[model samples]
Target chain A: MSAADLSRCSLNSATVKHASLTELVDAAAAAGLGAVGLWRHQVQEAGAEQAARAVAGAGLRVSSLCRGGFLTAADEAGIAAALEDNRRAIVEAATVGTRELIFVVGGLPAVSAPGQGPRPDAGPGDRDLVAARARVADRIADLVPFAAEHGVRIVLEALHPMFAADRAVISTLGQALDLAEPFPAETVGVVVDTYHVWWDPQLREQIARAGREGRLASYQICDWILPLAAEPLNSRGHVGDGYVDFAAISAWVSGAGYTGDVETEIFNEEIWADEPVATARTVGERYARYVRPYL
Target chain B: MSAADLSRCSLNSATVKHASLTELVDAAAAAGLGAVGLWRHQVQEAGAEQAARAVAGAGLRVSSLCRGGFLTAADEAGIAAALEDNRRAIVEAATVGTRELIFVVGGLPAVSAPGQGPRPDAGPGDRDLVAARARVADRIADLVPFAAEHGVRIVLEALHPMFAADRAVISTLGQALDLAEPFPAETVGVVVDTYHVWWDPQLREQIARAGREGRLASYQICDWILPLAAEPLNSRGHVGDGYVDFAAISAWVSGAGYTGDVETEIFNEEIWADEPVATARTVGERYARYVRPYL
Candidate 1:
């Protein structure tokens, strides 16, 4: 019942997206949160140095950097540019004193990195899947040395099915782990987000698999929306707000010897438009009631 | 290909929903289709007795009955009624000489049997996926004996995430198999509809597993529309229209040892508004292009 026990809790800045980087950090500290998670765009907008100073000043931990993915591009040059952008992201994470940079592997070549110029088109066939998957592994290999140099970990987050064509070829924890196998464990890890993975029957087994391999980088929670609309990426809800078994997952993470922070990361329009403090407070209280039972 | 070999293609009556049950059967036969799938309401409207005669008269095989699920009602009476209704459905399938009786397990009690009667309400916080699962198994247990007697198989269809709450508790092929294990394999089975299951990473493995277990009952195909509306059930597209790897699935089905008919079961507004012959020809041609590779 103690607020400090909220040590397990981390305020992913995406949850209180309306708040500026400084305001978000202050809100987390004021709410007695033990850690915070930041997004790269917000970090860039706030100035990485200023954001880092504010986070350290609040005596807060940066659980994870929002992301460094969408690597799929039309050509080799575009892919090279994506690798450079990811390296910069790793540097930004290092500046913020965080080691894990979450990766949402890009979807389709066009959608994942739209700014990249047009390239060859592949039909919707196994050959396309095989090529996309190979491209993902190759890019990860390219980024590994840069990630290693920064003492940073690359945590690939597998998205839901809708994004498979355009997003990550590695679309499940198992698939991500398979891609991570060739890389050093420390250099490549996985972020277990409830929103993307709760529907998986292999949830418990995969979490255990990640832990056993020492690949557990971040534990994130959101909700799974039903009757989903066109755009699958931005439809996430709050923990316990949808049909996912948050308590079961919380229990699984605890059992897996994962003592890291549990970050709340919702991408809903309704929640994002509300007051940031109100959002944080509601998230805090809900996590306590819905997730604490497992603890 | 010979028309008889081409005849193996079946029109899942849902493809030409605007056509009456008799017209669908007549069209399939005239087009030299080997089989057709029929829904209960369509049968009810056309009269199951008359529909059966028409299917037989056209020298058509009833590949599968459209559905007989939503067994997860709120009370004992509701449960009993569902069981009784399933028994009648088995008789109807037998009358039509169809081997498979497809079940779309009902969603949340309220949504499952809308306004049928008052029912017990389930909460969002309630994580009793176990109880819902048990109810599905229990209902199946009641119907297995009747299904066995009728020489008909009960195939539970895996629904999408949107229907997980109220429709079918068995939302995945693996989960559906788990629900089916207690029953005799000949009497209990699973229907693999690409629209419902194409997104599953475990699809190939599960389909292989179902084949090994000899529990794969039927294969249905429909397109999964991208940027789908909020509703999950109503947004299916025609065979070649969406992003699914239909050829790959056909390959999996063939590799998994299913020599049964592959039915096209589309429920799109555009196809529904088209002429029945146009819809049938479109489905047949699309199957030839996107799905015939495996066959």
Candidate 2:
């Protein structure tokens, strides 16, 4: 398939996670995918300006920045540090020419995050999920002006409920939209990642609500595989390889008036081991067959 | 602790899975638990009448039957078989002297159910989750009369969303309440298992709503432990061992007017390997410390 076959598809960096900044851009371009979702780590490694030039140089669009939220800090110092880092993330998003800056948003208070180790100093593990959710809303509010100034929207991504403890307190699209409703849609928006939200009972209603609110910033797709991995986070599959109903979800998004580029964001270990260009091409084929028709 | 110390506590059989029905009844009796939640398997193995007699002989009340709903089957045979099995489960619940019968509704279409192997003839994996959910509603409607006739309330248990693909399609209290609302509260009700729903943002309101509708049938507790086990089904912990805020959840349940036996139903491998009596007493101590005060 050529670029013409996958016009509306974007390859999320995590799909071919082994690929470096230069490698990913090249793979996306060679695979005939027109866009790439850049993670903050890769962007930082290449420096934002260089990364932007390289992406543009390859004739590809930057769909959105990977993440910048872990705002569930319990202590004052931790909270301040999280906000400061998010501010920097906004600047990087602006530099890279993508208005959307996805936020994985941290876990419940005092829990050990994946990349960040234990926060024993933060006091006993806080199971105040409501408080943590409120903290996310407040942090988004704090970053809204900065995000707006940088022309980057603080895109709220609700990780699946399974990750509510160690990855993100935001566990539903409805909750993310609630947090975004308080701000201008342009300044604060929510993502509709099928893998994280496909099982939600209120998904259709919430997707419609997100569209009506003018806060549907991005669309991410991946399949929910069976027999979860040893690490649940690595259990995602390619678009058609597992159990997600992409056609149904794509219709909902399209019905909601979201015409943005769809990003394929699989996190499977085996998929990552594939050649980056091959993975991108495979994502494009699956997206075309499973999602494009419905969209 | 004595029976007086945990007046409202019940030990679910799964908490001491290694014990036979006789041993479990005796262990729960010795541990001072005044009630027990019976799983259909053990009850089936011993004959429901004998199981009830044994529990009653130990001076233990049968709080509720473990489960009975896999109504999401796609094929006619699968659907009929599931309904027939659930009907038997209702009879078993009645024989065991419990008004409540919990349902862990089946997962997506065409997938191999945990105990049952693959369904190659069931056709390709059906991703019509909305359709699968609708099937559940229709099946529940079909079973309501039978459940009510036997003085059994068909209790909907919303398993954690992570289990949505393989275990239960019902994933939230609100969703469960919606399904239960079409029938009489005495005939159809919803369960609030804290392990399954503690992370829900709308949990407090939903619990209050479940109570308001007079459809809150059962209250089960266990902690949502960190580092989910390889088999996530066994990921639960004792009340005080994880990040769940039992005080907060218990207060909600109390405020919701659920004055019933609070069953401790942990499925941890380690806890199962412990001495049945020791595990029962440990569950009692944790429940008394973390959950009872607020209730």
Candidate 3:
């Protein structure tokens, strides 16, 4: 497939970990891909301005920024630090020329995340999910003005419920939208990631509702694989390698009137071990075969 | 706390895997737990009639049965076998003196579950979650008459979304309620298992809804522990050990007017390794400190 054939598909930077922002940009441009999605860490490592320049130099679009939300902090200092980091993230996202800054809104307090241990600075243990969720809202409200001023949409990504205990409080597109609805569409949005949400019963209606609300900031694709016990964070597969029905999901995205770039943000260890350019090419090929046709 | 304090705390048989039904019943009665929940496998191993006799002999009430639903079959033979097995499960539940028979509706097709391999009898492969869920509803419908005839309520247990692929497709208390509402309250009901549902955003409302509709069949508890990657099926901890705010959750269950036995269905390896009587005593102690107060 030509670059035009891969027009709507975007390779998320985390998918190819060894590559710097410049290398990812060049590889995406050379691999017949039209755009690349960047992670905040990668852009910061290369310096956001330099990363922006690299993408511009390669004539490729920056689809969206990888992440910018752990706003479930309960302590005052932790909350202050989280807001500061998010403000910096918004500035970096603006520098990278992507309006969407994804937020993995944090999970239940004190619970340890896989590999990444407990947040050292969280308040005296909070297990009240309701209170933690309310805190997430208040913190987002604090950041909305800064995000809007920087021309960035705070995009909420509802991870699979496995992460609900320690990674993300927002565990469904519906919940993400509930949080998003309180803010303007340009200031707050939600991501439709297939791997994270393929199991949700309300996904289709929620996708349409997201588009209708003009909060569909990003459309992401990745297959939900087997041997799920391997590791929650790295169990994703190529589009057709798992149980996700990409055709039906892509059609839902298209029906939602979302013409935005469909990004692949897989976290599998095996895919990360492969060559960057080859992985990018395979991502596009899988998108064309399993997703694009339905869209 | 005395045995009277543990009036509502029921120890699920899965927590004491090595013990035979007679031993478990004797231990529960000795441990001052008013009831002991039985699993179909244990009941079958001891003979359902013999299990019922042991429970009666020990003056211990049988709480809900462990499970009887993997009814996501797409083929005729598979569907027929599931119904047959469920009928036997109903008979076993009746024989064991429990009105409730729990169902863990199976997950997406061909995926390998933790420890348990893929079901060789499952159809070619069903990836459409919507279709699989619809199939679950259909199979449950097929089981209702038999269950009702046997004076058993077909109970649905919503697993955490982590198990949405290979263990259980029903992933929320609300989804379970939705499935349960279609049948008469006596014919179909839902379980409120804290470990599987503590993360849901709509849990409080759904709990109330389940109460209002008279579809709340079972109340089970087990702490949602840390180091979640240990194993999905065996990661449960003792009450108050993990991030579950049992006080608040028990308050909700009480507010919903649930007067039934609050069972503990923990599956932790460490807990199972302990002597059965000791484990039951610890379970009661934890329930008294963390859960009984709220109730």
Candidate 4:
């Protein structure tokens, strides 16, 4: 596994979130990586136009934009606001020169305002997950023309079920593909992130279906760490540190004919503490050894 | 929502883990509850035969046995040991006189023995979840004959996906039902515990399927609490306390024609801190308010 084998490797800016967009782009290019996946906040910090110019100047491809969806609001005002925000995200993705804009599709609406703690009046009867998910589907359909017009694809990422309530109601690749089915494959696709979907029983079949339908938008890699952190969001491990079968899953993705950027997107606090350049080098090496062979 | 409507309520002993088998039986009976679910250790402390006698003497039914399967071992000896333990559990379930013996089928075998922190040499490539799941299927087939002879149904309970690596690989009702399909539904079944499975997107369809197949062995109820505990196992909330929609899910189960015991099987430190009798009464009231109408 040499630097030459890392030609398809992409550094997701969130993996080294401490780094500025400029620093991530520079580190990724210096490490001989072919692409970089940018987060919305990081791109905004560098200014989307400047971020695009920097990546292009560094001779690196913009693999994808971090995210753009939170359409599960209980009220009309909230729904309208979410759609407006997503339309802006589509424009941002277009500005950053990436066709793939991942959408996490938010979870159930909050019963009360933030920091109110658990609602004392709340009961088991208040949540309607099915309705929340339906709203996500409808909102995605609404955003399809906007995204397509901007030449950006809406990549629906299925978060692990642990985040089903507060992060993403779409918890499996099959479900994401199901939601994406009504739209054009190029305009709406699904993300095959190993961190979220590795435990899925229907992973192989779903990946195959996504490939068959030309809906395999982006292939992201990360590990599932044990003793999950207090903030479960930061529990993702470096590629070789946890229990995901990356080689097998990567082979499935590669076999499905996905020839796109392979992003190493981790969210561990420990990994975030490392120097950006060193983290990029380490991730690149791991990707070469663990994932490149399969590809 | 009167005591008459509570005729199907059962106190799962784990919901009050501090209580002895005798105390559980007596409290459940005194509360006018119809049944009590027993755990093996609690029954052993009271002596299984004596425990059976006491429950009968108290005129209470044994709703189900707490557990019986951990067949995800990699080595032959480990696999044999697990099967042997499950055999004993089958006998214990029969002794306690309950047809439903719920199995929280264990997760992937540890790379090394206990107390060795995450295996340094282990990687995602080392764990074979597909093979581990296949072993669970094979072991369940091996135990079906014994369970049949004892007239005890082997109930496979899908633990939450967060427990996929260390607790139970059977992480969805659909997967559990798929595993149980090769065997007789009467000899092998699936436990639909709300805490473990409420996040599943295909939950309603799977519950309906479980009913149509007559394999809905146990209907356990508990809430999915927020800010999950440091140890996820203790995160189960009392019925009205968390985000689970009991009325909706229970309606689905009831609509499927399930008339079994509704076991309130919670595992929270806060709930366990209460007096056993008080806890039983509170749970009964909550069940009457939140779940009884649907049933």
Pairs in clash, predicted candidate 3: none
For candidate 3, write residues B93-163 as lDDT tens digits: 99889998899998875654543444455342467788889999999888888888899998899998878
Each candidate's iRMS in angstroms?
6.4, 3.6, 3.0, 2.7
lDDT of 2 by residue, B6-105 (tens): 8789999999998999999898888898799989999999999999999999899999998899899888999899999999999999999999999999
Per-candidate Cα lDDT values, in order, are 0.78, 0.88, 0.85, 0.87
Report the lDDT tens digits of candidate 4 across residue range B1-295: 4567667899999988888887898788777788899999987878778989999998878999988888888779988899899999999999988999999887767545322235776645347788889989999989999999999999999988888877788989999999999999899999889998888889999999999999998999998777778777888888877777788899999987899999999889998989888888877888898899888
Task: Sort candidate 1 into its docking category.
Answer: acceptable
User: Taking the tens digit of each residue's C-alpha lDDT, what string does model 1 give over B82-106?
Assistant: 8888888888888767889999877
- Model 3 ranges with Cα > 4 A deviation: A112-125, B112-125
DockQ of each candidate relative to the true complex = 0.31, 0.51, 0.51, 0.50
Q: Which ten residues in a row have the lowest lDDT in candidate 4 chain B?
A: B109-118
lDDT of 4 at A39: 86
Which lDDT value does model 1 have at A63? 93
lDDT of 1 at A59: 86
True contacts kept of each: 0.23, 0.44, 0.45, 0.34
Give the range of the ten consecutive residues with the poorest summed lDDT in model 3 chain B: B115-124
Model 3 residue B5 distance off true place after TM-score fit, in angstroms: 0.4
iRMSD (Å), candidate 3? 3.0
Which candidate tops lDDT?
Answer: 2
lDDT (Cα, 0-100) at B127 in candidate 4: 71
